[model samples]
Target: MQKLRRYLALGGLSVGMTVLAACGASPTATTGPAATTAATTAAATARPSTAPAASATIAPAGVTRTASASVTTPAATATRATTPAAATATRAGTVTSGTATRTGSPTALVTPSQAVSNLQRLDNSRQTWAFTGFTVAGLSGNLNPVFEYNGGNQKVTLAAGGTNLEAYQVGGVLYVRAPIGGVIQADASNPLAAPAQTLFATPAALLTALVPANTSYTVAGTETINGLQATRYTASVALTDLGFVNPALAGQGGTAATTVWVDTTQGVLVALQSNITAAGSNTAATARLDVTQIGQTPAIVVPR
Candidate 1:
């Protein structure tokens, strides 16, 4: 699979106009900003009213008496009495509503590593997916592969040099569909056989090997891909994290801008893209992979 590896180099497979209407000239500035100011001098006299004040008397020992002039309306009194209870009820309702929202919406994965982990878990189940990838190393190539997994049986349609090659692995043997339409045992001679065996034989182990730990990433946003809602995450990952051992790239591992999409509903990995570069080399490798069809894919049937 040197051709495939060469095509996927980089640790392998680093894949308005808002219109505002003018409001009627502000009514001609409402009389030109109103007159500056006007003052008039006038004489006045102050007088005190002869209303009787509340009487207060000194009480006996251990007693106290005080007087004041304050009045409240019936509506004001009723409002003051019920305000606390109303506020308490509103607070309780708000808390309940917030809790419901948290429970109803899917919990977002805090880290990209967690998203990758979820991908592994979902990839192991009985599901189907199609991955389309493009890589640039020495040769620029595109790969579209559809995979179907059920229990321990799997089938895939691989793309190679404009040929749709079908492959099936059952009971520990890789079988390639011949041009004449029967099954052929895949040996070391076929370029795609080894890679297919390595990739499909162990479920999602390749994914674990592909994405590295210690990757710094953040949640980019949410997007819809292949009819599934997915959370997008962006990160900077070192080529070394992907197991790139090129002598031209060393130290800090030469970072790559990486982004991944995971299904918002089930946490399954939906898509990924990476742009990788070497330390001193001008050429860069770009790759993208997207998984679709999910649990709705048809069953894979071994060729009779």
Candidate 2:
């Protein structure tokens, strides 16, 4: 755009001068119109500029030819100076994509396609992981969950508003303790059976359930989550992507903008945070999941 033009021209000039200065002296530089005219006139008068004798002297053809080349080369070389500027423009990429090249304009921004690909690969190599994250959004205000999954077992604690609930699952049996429900027992409805069904199923489930449709994921950077190194990725996805089978979760359905962290080494989902909005409302709800334990956690015991 208008911002980049001055830079490209200056860059090209700098490049050309450097190339010219390195060449030392070439014959083309010294040859000029005046020297050429003098030689032409001498030939017409039957005289040589370097005379052995008027009739016997040979013109210094080599020197005259070299000088002629040198003079013209420098003019043509004015274009070369702009070469460096062109290179810098490409690097800066300040302009929009698919634009024609101009003196000081840029081309295109770098895409996050590679980072998304890496995240997909991590999903493919899912493993046992534990994470924790605090989330805040307009509809859902401040809900935090810390959970761990080992094979077919699950232990999770959820706190929302002023309500707290804890659940433990061993094989097909699930145990829940809550302020309103006291000690509740449930059979089947196992998380392992929902979707991929394995250790650190979160990465596979979240990716399958709620990756935003027709959107790009941005790799914000890396961070240490609970003493573990993880790569952070963020995306805005529709509410439907969560694939909510649970009545409670389905009721709160809305578009969610999520930020997730995955272990760089194992590619397991280490932490996730999301802001959610309801189907017909603009109010946002926030939720967070952090797996602080990875591949290691104490046994899950059911309360009798």
Candidate 3:
């Protein structure tokens, strides 16, 4: 917590300045909400596969929000654990299901609820998966966070500048380790948990919010991403549908071209990409999150 505090303190003034500059400058920035939201939600593959060009003119579909449980985070502190001084590489996940279940036909359209439900269900099933992505907005540097989940166990490694923090939630115990502060056990009630949660929750929650009941998307065939075959869906939605309340976008009109990949058989979310742009503007912001190594991560036993 101390190291994280110091890192935030050092960047606080710079962050503020960057925001002001972004608001005044032209909108040609590569950073925006899409990046930040996906950062909390997913990752990039070390060996990425390209999808066909995505379009926003797909016929809109009628959809409604479906309730899903929030991904649980540990609430109690536990004994100290070994602390690594730097970020570590995570292996891709394996499929917990013996045979992945494919969903929808090549011609079938997908609803936002269906897409989100598959993601939430995967989380609930205790199926192991991992993702790594970076969030950047305004002039702030990118924050790359890696997340891995296995049943009730979860781990996240967040780094910015040279400060790195690792957190693990195994069963009911939570442990946080930073390069400078060693390790401390904490729960959801700890104030320090707030920032970590903010960084972690954005991706998953934002993906849900971004694909509200009004989205229209179609399957674009199956592609292999990090060893998993996932059906890709593409859509274009108004910025409002994505929970963006920007007055400028509202008045000027904006849209997001989104593409997502879901496990063919298991329906788990495999990757997501969104490009947001206001009409009549040359500038656009894009965000992407990719999940790999479903069911294959090393066990997250109580950190030793």
Candidate 3 at residue 246, lDDT?
29
Mind giving the per-residue lDDT tens digits that candidate 3 earns over 1-304?
A: 9999999987997887688797885344446666866765554431232221122222122111111112221211111221221212121122322223223342133454575676665543222222222232211235556777778677777666666667777776677774455667777776556556554455566576556566777767778875777778888866633223222333455677878777666656667777777667764556667676666667776554
Model 1, position 155, has a per-residue lDDT of 80
How does model 1 fare in lDDT? 0.57
Give the winner by TM-score. Answer: 1
> How accurate locally, in lDDT, is each candidate?
0.57, 0.53, 0.57
What TM-score does candidate 2 reach? 0.40
Worst 10 residues of 2 by lDDT: 102-111
Tens digits of per-residue lDDT for model 1 on 1-304?
A: 9887777575342320111114334443545445322111111111112122112222422143222212345657788989999999999999998777544434363355666676655533333332222221211245555567655567876665656667888777788877674777788896657656644633353344335667666777677876777778887765543223222332534556777777767766777776766555654655556666666556666777
Worst 10 residues of 3 by lDDT: 61-70
Backbone clash pairs for candidate 1 read 15-286, 15-287, 15-288
Of the pair 2 and 3, which is ahead by TM-score? Answer: 3
TM-score, every prediction: 0.54, 0.40, 0.52
Model 3: residues >4 Å from true position, as ranges?
1-112, 123-139, 187-191, 241-254, 278-283
